[model samples]
Target: MPSFYSKKDLFFQLFENQNCLELTQLPYFSDHSKETFTLVLEAAEQIAEKSLYPIFREMDRQEPQLVDGKIRIHPAMGTIIRKFGEDGWINAIFPYEEGGQQLPWVIHLAAGFIFQASNYSASVFPFLTTGAANLIRTFGSKELKEKFTPKMFAGKWQGTMALTEPDAGSSLSDLTTTATPASISGVYRIKGQKIYISAGDHDACENIIHLMLARIEGAPSGTKGISLFVVPKIRLDGAPNDVLTQGIYHKMGYKGAPIAHLMMGSQEECEGYLVGEAHQGLKYMFQMMNEARLGVGMNAVAIATAAFQASLAYAKERPQGRKISEKDLSKPQVPIIEHSDVKRMLLFQKSVTEGALALLIYCGILSDKIAQETSAAKKLKMEALLDLLTPIAKSYPSEMGVKSTSMAVQVLGGAGYTTDFPVEQYFRESRIHPIHEGTTGIHGLDLLGRKVWLQEGLGWKTLQQEIQHSLDQVKSIQELNDLGHSFEEIFLKFNHSAGELLFKRNLGPEKFLADATLFLEASGILCVGWMWIKQAISAQKAISSGALEQSFYLGKIETARYFMEYELVKILGLIPRFHAASYPTVTMEKDWF
Candidate 1:
């Protein structure tokens, strides 16, 4: 199999084709160029291959354990994390004043994909830390930033977003964790139990900073009352904060990272500094949640990418049954890659994984655009469009990622099911992507229930205009015109189906969103179709210019065509059901099963 580094050109080309470098014109990213991005990717690729990938299976087999009331992870985790921090990867996207390179988020995430594809479980520690540091940097006070942000960015300390509780799950309103006024100004005494906290407690770092959510005394119930807190495992005075690690939850895969159950302030001594305001914790968390959602999707894409490459390599070397045309037993068996069914499976994985990477990287580009955009109206429009696409960005790559990995496994047959190969591990790891950040069902509801109709449905309308823009850009390209027209037709049907559902809003929640998951599925297909169309056009431009990597560009175009023909067409059959808005699931009684 080709090393993940071997595909650097494909990723960089996609990044450049998407105009990611435009962010350099922004004051924050002024120092960066295409060459700078290459330098960053090269550094990351070296770390991934040399340090992370070597221990991928070892870390999983050893797994993190709560030994003697302290979490102990694989020994190599400490070295990899130190390298990540010292290399400036933890702070790559932050401002230079904060000891960062001020690189564009697009490049940051592109490097992120390489690291993640190499070893997701081990790679998660830095990713989660970056997210936590960003949350505090964006919303924390000067004091909070001054004290903790620098250490985190320097990778001296680790950070985590701790939101899930034993009883609350995804419902923040039901949270019972409480915060009270502390002796120190802006600080509070916090008491709560958090569950399923990733990188919660590990021996790899000197300190663990948790961006936890809790309800303050006398605050209103539900999401409105939740408040954000900066809870550290060790206090500034060097005494342990009242944070206790109950245990590590054994997972099905990605076993290298530890997920902990934490009891905060069991001894009533946990000190937490409030972030932003008293009752806006949920809002702050959502900012982190949105970023995490994209990370989840990226992780999915990376896993499937690895699986595809592995399977493709295996298919080329593993000789199977003779070709159908060869009737004699004496004939030598050909490689399975010669089989049409195997080719189909490989193409399925390629289309889904590559298309997913494009969509996610495009999301990163949009994020940079929002930061550089000074126009208030345009920024608002972009924000709206991002809101509408977030669920799809999170859901499609994830849900389809599972299917793509399954296809990878299928290509490997029985070997894919056993521990002898990594495909089984990839399949196991991909399962959690759809369930993390937000489950597919949660995102489905968010898409249909809130985002679609926000700003008098302007979010949805703005997306339509963008899709039309892609269609216009490809109309003159001879080879893509038919695919373009097919996309336009499917989008029309999509709009009409959505229109019918919008018309039934007054029919109550059940009737309004009975088929919301299907709607999400259809919408995900449409979004990926748009991304593939954009990729194909980019490839055509490259081919017209006599680019050196002709085969790579051609492969992109072919994959886009395959996705349109086999995957995008599924929406046609789904539109009728989307329009139906049938309440069958809602109407079915609990006892029906």
Candidate 2:
């Protein structure tokens, strides 16, 4: 019961330093203020600690079960859902007219981190529901929104995105699900099996709304012909829809939320309403997918944050051998935290988790700016920035969260490996994130294959320009000059490396993308390096102003420095890997493996 997550001071200071409240000037958030943001965060924290945190272990211990084809989750989850729904955290970013708080995306994300850090499994249903509902609100017809959005937003119903199938996995082009036109104007009969669906079914709500993907019969093959649909578990006429729970998947982590295999139209009665025009399901779903990717990044950070705190606390109290310089035979043992190696491990976790959090929070702020900006050009530029950052934002944190939590385990030695501490659970849960939104492989392809080159490389260029602006701000700070210059070289190297890939495009797409994952890994490291530098600048400003929380500000600066000196240098190893003309992966024969 030692505090797993109690970092309100650091969290709030990040919000203030990031200028999250500046979004209030926009009409969408005009009614809100700093006070409103704090109120919502407190409400979320109250629910997280009072309701969710207390039962996190129990929920994990007793994973959801499939009883007579009905999935039964932890009983405690129902209360958490109700409390969040009532408090509007379930729909915090929805428009006010739609019964939401109309809070800025950054603040909403901050609140989400609180709950996720406290108990991600309990918090996941609402997160899935919010993303599903947002897709409907953005693209669904009036009838669809009116019937579904309110119920979902009110927490009377749950929502899920149904995209993955038995064979498709991440390849939407291969999905075999089919839809046929129904007599109703917008309705279609859905017939497909979606696997690994989170919150796919549960008894905590009156209904489960599935934002599903399928192909119309005889539609063109691959992703182009696919379409999106609103498939409900229960039909409007009060009978069960043809959606059947084939089985509930037991996972190593995130055990509280059921991962289900679902069969739609098994009884040939599954009715689905299309969200938009045909052959646009992938396009529409990509929006939700991107949102989910962002969520994945945040979830990874939250879990790692908890692991770091637990390990840090234990390190401070656990007595071990004397320091390297000490004659240990004659003296009492010092805390493990005083040991250089233990501190190094903890610092690695701290740097990665904190830097990842700052990067994702910055993405959230850009998300709000994109929503509120009036100028079409500015909006387009903001969109490009988001496009470029999304892959790194999703992959870096996820991939590193696994590494960070593993270090947390190393910090505690034996206890970290056992259920006596939650670090092991954190480690298990963090592994799924890289595979969840899109595998690191897929994201790397997206980054190097498409996002970086899309719109004539506008996204890549815009991101570099912004990073340069941050470095510019630190020029007059003599102490940061050398680090700022080092980051500049890092940026130039990334830009040049990307240019090399673009130049090699004529060699064949296969060769061009041969080391795409390595490219992504390199980019992720550099992007996070940029974030740490920005945080350092923010901390420096606070320190100069003689902030009351001097220790907090000092900690931020030191963490930033640690990341730059230790983690950021990783990009050097990948640079040569990026330059290889013939990747061994593509050269190996199929029989070799």
Candidate 3:
């Protein structure tokens, strides 16, 4: 069973006391899990520390260029990524039956942080391939899976999820990609233009599997009419080697990760095979998309985490600000760390990144439960929890991840805005997340809109009960008692605030909907406060046990305390705003803008 206290010792000290992380265990962690996962995280850190981070600045400086309607990525990056595929990095979460590491999603996500933090743009295509590949495996026939799984898992063929169009984006029901049955055996004739597909035209792999969505003939209109297919850039039968560059998109960030505007079946037919039942594409695609939402959230957190580390290092080394107690203005202004405001920014960044990571990894643990639990009832509960957490997991961390990155830039001042440092790049990369899987508002609406209604509200109730349990546990631990009490107050404030909003005149329109973003933020903060108290309790135990890294443990306790003091303390404000949730922003005239 996962303790309220154990994970704290293993989190931040991942680099130094990874052995301690090794010693730590999750209730759902299989016997082989620690050995299997820690290396993934370590390897992720390696990629971030080595390959991706070094190139991030250059990546921002030189966005992917569209030359003759094709994208040629950084010279050695294609090879490096191919090496990543060869190394099983892309296939960690694939089923072992599929020639993958068969690791849990959380571990894959933990490792993902390394890649995304280092260079998100470069990893987008390969990672998206994993999602696309899994979609095929889940919904496609055995023939499709057998034919495509190996190469995709092995990174021989990359993958892309194409849902957006010139007019349809967010509204899948309104998409126009058309599909017609082919005269050929087991094939669907696909003809559509898919835009903004990452790795859509990359030369990293032999074939790019386009999971294109389209409307079947005489089908129900809107989302129900759409069917998904495994449409490859090049038709592959017995032998699979086609590196055709159809078209490329010039993008804002992630320049190294090529984006494409594909015109499928315009030439020789873009042969595709149906994955799931006709008109059930949206359901199947959501599996990958939901997974990607979690991935995107973690990516945002990782980027922010990297910025925090860099900013922390810079604040300590940059000799600009003087000590608050220093009488001498001439005292060479010690490092920026001396300034209370700078420290506050650093703390906020650290609080979000570390706290976000804690929640993200634990969500992974919950995933393991949802996947592995044998009992139907228990598995059902796990599924509900998973559903409840996904929106917050995707929405909360992503917003704060961007917030943290921006603050990192603030820490660097002018240098942060320029290409000289990578924080600005972190911000730029993070800026894409709100739109990556779903916008913050969508996630917000999901949380308030759908999550509250799912499983008869069992998931939300379970989460509230769990937080209550943690709140009680906080009172039991002497070291964490004060923080616990403070958190309890914050928790109650948040709960009361949410209740007022719900009871208020019906959560008015976009203005109230806009509050949905802040609602996600509050929920996420409350959730992490629970995680932090648990972590601090563990840190207290680690210190009691005469651990060598008491300083590290102490830092964990301190950071959690700081979070309670500042971040969690802010939850008190939501009460007043939430009371006005029923108001409508639609009252405004269109011409007012």
lDDT of 1 at 467: 87
CA lDDT of each candidate? 0.87, 0.85, 0.75
Could you give candidate 2's per-residue lDDT for residues 1-593 as a string of tens digits?
44656565446444655777678788788898878877877777787778888988888899999999889999877766876677787788887778887878778787888888889899898878899999999999988999898878878789998989989998889999999999988889999899999999988988899999999988999889999999999977779998999999999898989999999998888999999888899999999898888889999998999999989999999999997888758899989999888888988988888888888888998998898889999999899889989999999989999999999999989998999888888888888998997899999899988998778888888988888888898777887787787777777887787677678778888888888888888888888888878887878887888878888778877777777778877887777776777678888999998
Q: Give me the overall lDDT of model 1.
A: 0.87
lDDT of 3 by residue, 15-124 (tens): 23223233224333434445655666667666666676677667667766667756667765767667778888777766566666656666677667767766777767
Candidate 2: Cα lDDT at 249: 92
**Which is the better candidate, 1 or 3, if ranked by lDDT?**
1
**How does each model score on TM-score?**
0.97, 0.97, 0.91
Ranking 2 against 3 by lDDT, winner: 2
lDDT string for model 1 (164-271, tens) is 899988777899989999888889999989999999999999999999999999999889999999999999889999999997999998999999999998899999
lDDT of 1 at 365: 85
